[model samples]
Target chain A: MVVNASQDDPEKARRFREAALPYLDDAYTLARYLLRDAADAEDAVQECYLRAYKHFDSYRGPAMKPWLFAILRNVCRAEYARRKTAPTAVEELPEGGDQTPMWNEAPETPEKQMLRRFDGDTVRRLVAALAEPFRETFVLREIQNLSYREIADVAAVPVGTVMSRLARARAMLRSAWLAEQEQAK
Target chain B: MTCEEAEVLIHALIDGELDAGHAREVEVHIEGCAHCAVLMKEYQEIRQAIAESDLRYKAPLELRRKIEKALPQPQPQAAPSRRSVLRGFAMGSAVSAMAATGLVAIVLRNDDEQRIENEVVSAHLRSLQAGHLIDVVSTDQHTVKPWFNGKLDVSPPVIDLTAQGFTLIGGRLDYVNAREIGAVVYKRRQHVINLFVAQTANTERKTAKVSTLQGFNIRRWSDRGLNYWAVSDLGADELSEFGDKFESAMRANKEG
Candidate 1:
């Protein structure tokens, strides 16, 4: 008898696969955004699944998305530290940036046409451009559609921090979208 | 609600995170306020654009298949040995460390030893990352020793030197030379000394070889059909001393 038996138990493994495998795409998306390298992202996702499986029996959460994502975040974070990469590059909103309606002064393009401009690649690029904690918050909200409470649990930050981060993330995203639109003109 | 009061709530409102009373309050504020209305629309459009863009990366089919196949089971296929079973223990952490900053694309070319050293140093760097310094966390050498019994081909020598300057922190499996090996972790002050041991087919009198790579020093030696590599950012003299202390402790245990 070993300290860990679920590893050798087919039933537990099956349950874990059912609970955790459905979110593989979600996990990959987060990892791809965090690492920005396909190979590295795949490696991180693999590590996340392995780590999650090892501790699957201990998991008692209602949802598997956040729990699995939390594991993935740590894996990518370790990669960041291992590479000794620079800290997340946070872009500050300019003075009165959000005070004025950010999209107000743009040349009068139809809202429909303007939004259609945000193609998949462009949207992904802008989202990826967001800094850490903020980028992570934005992805969890807009992409994964996790509730703020779930996000707070996954990120291990206070609910207030998540709210403020979402606010900042939205502001940053809007401003970045406007800037990109302006450049296109 | 004042514009200032409703400003922060708009995000929650857009996400439908707000309660009925608060959501109504934000709705009231936006109805009366044009600026707030525009802001709300902008946020909604951003969310919509992202959704329409379909940015979620579906895990590739190969990746899905790979993960499904690798899930540990009572009788799993493709995992040939304990080494593969313990491979996850070794790759427990994603890698980033100060030493890894200087890692450029270096061609190992014809030197197999050089390639192995690079990988060993890389594993050391990865283990330094937080939340994964050790998989089996214990200062007790007794507990740490047996953890690798079924996980690895050979049990690595886990020496407890809490009485000495170095403290036996814990142990984890680390990938080195393309095999899952045991890494006995110790800490001297703040520095981590990772002792990686692997089984050698042909035992030879390989004396202690000290080498420095990527801002870390590795002191390696072999004994009784096993190879050992102790890597740390600790000074060469100090790490070598740790290696010496460990070797004697292992010898004394074997003899006595």
Candidate 2:
């Protein structure tokens, strides 16, 4: 079996590998959220990394995560755009109580909080309930600890927008979470 | 002092975006202002919850590995002979140009800055690999500064940027230009600027040049034996401004 010319450049290949390593989980997470399907998310991530590697020379900074994320975000957008007309209903808890306000619950001890963990299904539903922008901001800021500026850079928005979206995202998440408990009742 | 102002700034304060003076003011207000304080705590708690939530699903490890394996490589045929390397270079340049224009169009037409920002992100990664990342790690500048005394013949001045909307998150010993260097880490809106500092041997750190390599903006300058390279995915103007502010602060502390 012969390796192709594209696979021969180990340095470039390693650069891509290393750069994509730390951020693979993150990229996948973002893609999963955007596509709402594991396979599509995986595909999106794979495509995004390839797109990123080809254009890696255009990147000139110390951090690779945000840049890779930016690429992943673009790939997700492209995928989403193609499937724009698909009849995917935003998931909603039946007989909803506006939004999940469980986020308003007072901060509890970390251990107690773990005991109160929502099931995977509930968490999925709650994330699904959020508007795309809010969901994306929430994931990048809350899940990834990306700076508002970095989120803004990745989302291609102003930092102010990142904050607002995050706030709204939290608000929506809180409502969705509360709705989950209500449904469980 | 007002509740409205406090609310807008509360998240900023928690994120450490406020100046020291403003932070102090916010801290003082939070002690007396019940409603504003509650709101602040709520936001923080909400942020914490979101961070902990499994709201965003993790991509399977196998998928991640497969993606890594599929990354593209540069064409070797383009760089085969030294004499033909120039021709290869010309073709490569043209290809890159076309790719650049197409990419910019894709990114801009998508009305998303995230993809365009990756250009800066690549530069940020390059700096991380240039040498060891930092020169200090102690919470106190005093400890960090003294540690570099003998390691570097001319010590690069170290001052905390925490007060000026840049929190001195940490520091590490780094290598640049075949010499031991200092890298001070700071966070601005969560974007980490790994500020690489080394004594210029003798040159003043005044002339600032912002260069974008692989999309990362590197603001390089020399001031009072300290050569500073503020590398981040941050835009040119912001990095340049940050370099200016940092240089001034370093200079002022020296005079004081």
Off by over 4 Å in 2: A1-8, A87-121, A178-185, B1-5, B51-58, B72-256
lDDT of 2 at B12: 70
Give the TM-score of chain A in candidate 1: 0.80
Per-residue lDDT of B245 in model 2: 81
lDDT of 2 at B162: 68
Candidate 2 steric clashes: 45
Candidate 2: tens digits of C-alpha lDDT, residues B41-122:
6557655655565554545545644664465433322212322323323354443454444321111223222332343344
Worst 10 residues of 1 chain B by lDDT: B90-99
Provide the fnat value for model 1, as a fraction from 0 to 1: 0.69
Compare the candidates by lDDT and give the number of the best one. 1
Candidate 1 lDDT score relative to the true structure: 0.75
Which residue runs of candidate 1 sit more than 4 Å off their true CA positions?
A1-8, A85-116, B73-256
